[model samples]
Target: MEFTTALFYVFAAILILAATQVITARNPVHSALFLVLAFFTASGIWMLLKAEFLAIVLVLVYVGAVMVLFLFVVMMLDIDLDKLRAGFWSHFPLALTVGVVVVLEMSAVLWRGFLTVGRQIHGDSGNIGDTKNLGLVIFTHYQLAFEVAAAILLLAIVAAVALTLRRRKDSKYVDPAQAVKVQSKDRVRIVKMKAESDRVTLAATEKQGN
Candidate 1:
């Protein structure tokens, strides 16, 4: 086998193992970590296929950002494993049914498709590095779609921040809306008053006279 084929098999095997571990790990944090590993291996496989853009995106978007967010969420949340698992057996039938259906559908698709090993689409094409070409297509033909996606992501981030900063009845927190609505009259008071030094001097003069 060629070195590229051998490397592809190595990455595919690692990807499968990592994916299995992701499902089997008892701890949620460990499962998230394994998922990151799985994503990395998948990126490697994509690299072998010469999908440079997809491979880099799989690693950067999934492993760097999404998995970190998943780990953060899983770690920050209070989860009762035992209580959560209590309904597992009861739900097993439904889960298994869904799983089996998905598996059957995937298997049927695979059966219909012919498998060819050692065949690459690029096949040593000088333009194997299609990252620049992909970018041009995206920014030129799909510019509107790309802009919309970015807008959606920005809105999601803003919404997340708003939700996180929302007021809670039990917490001692200031309402930003109320604060913003406040006039200078509500926030400040102007009073005529003598200086402390003047007040002290007047008091001392009165005492000496007495």
Candidate 2:
């Protein structure tokens, strides 16, 4: 076998193992860390496949930014591991059935030469191929789908921000609009007073009453 092919197999094995660990690990943080490893290995596989743009994006986007955020979230949340695992046994049969159905479907599709079509497409690429050509095809043919995906992602981001803005009784937050609208005239009071004569007249009236 070619050296690249051997390395591809190695990376694939590691990727699969890491992915399985991601789902099977009891600790949420550990699962996230394993997912990061899976991303790294998948990036390596993409590199071997000569998809440099995808490889770099996988490392930068998933491994660097997304995984870091996931790690922080997992650490900050108080997840009960035992509670999470409690229903595993009850859910196992349904999960296994779904898994088997998915596997069978994948096998039927792949066995009918779908996987070969992917290899054929990749094999037809020239030595000078780059992300520029990929971008052209995506923008020209799949522009609508691309835009829809972006819109979906934007909605997800807005939803996340809205959820984070939910009212919390224990939290103190400032209203920026209220702060900005305050004027100097509204903040200060100017008081003018007479000299000690006015004060002495007020004191003499009190003494006469006594």
In terms of TM-score, the best-performing candidate is 2
Off by over 4 Å in 2: 112-129, 163-173, 181-210
User: What is each predicted model's overall lDDT from 0 to 1?
Assistant: 0.86, 0.86
lDDT of 2 by residue, 6-115 (tens): 99999999989998999988888889999999999998988887788888898999989999999998899898888888999999999999999999998998788755
**Residue lDDT tens for model 1, 1-210:** 999999988998898898899888889999999899899888888888778888888888998999999999999999999998899899999999999999999998786665653445432353444877666667877899999999999999999998898667889987689989999999899998889999899999999999
lDDT of 2: 0.86
Q: Report lDDT (Cα) of residue 43, candidate 2.
A: 86
Cα distance off (Å), candidate 2, residue 132: 1.4
What's the CA RMSD for each of the models?
4.9, 5.8
TM-score of each: 0.68, 0.70
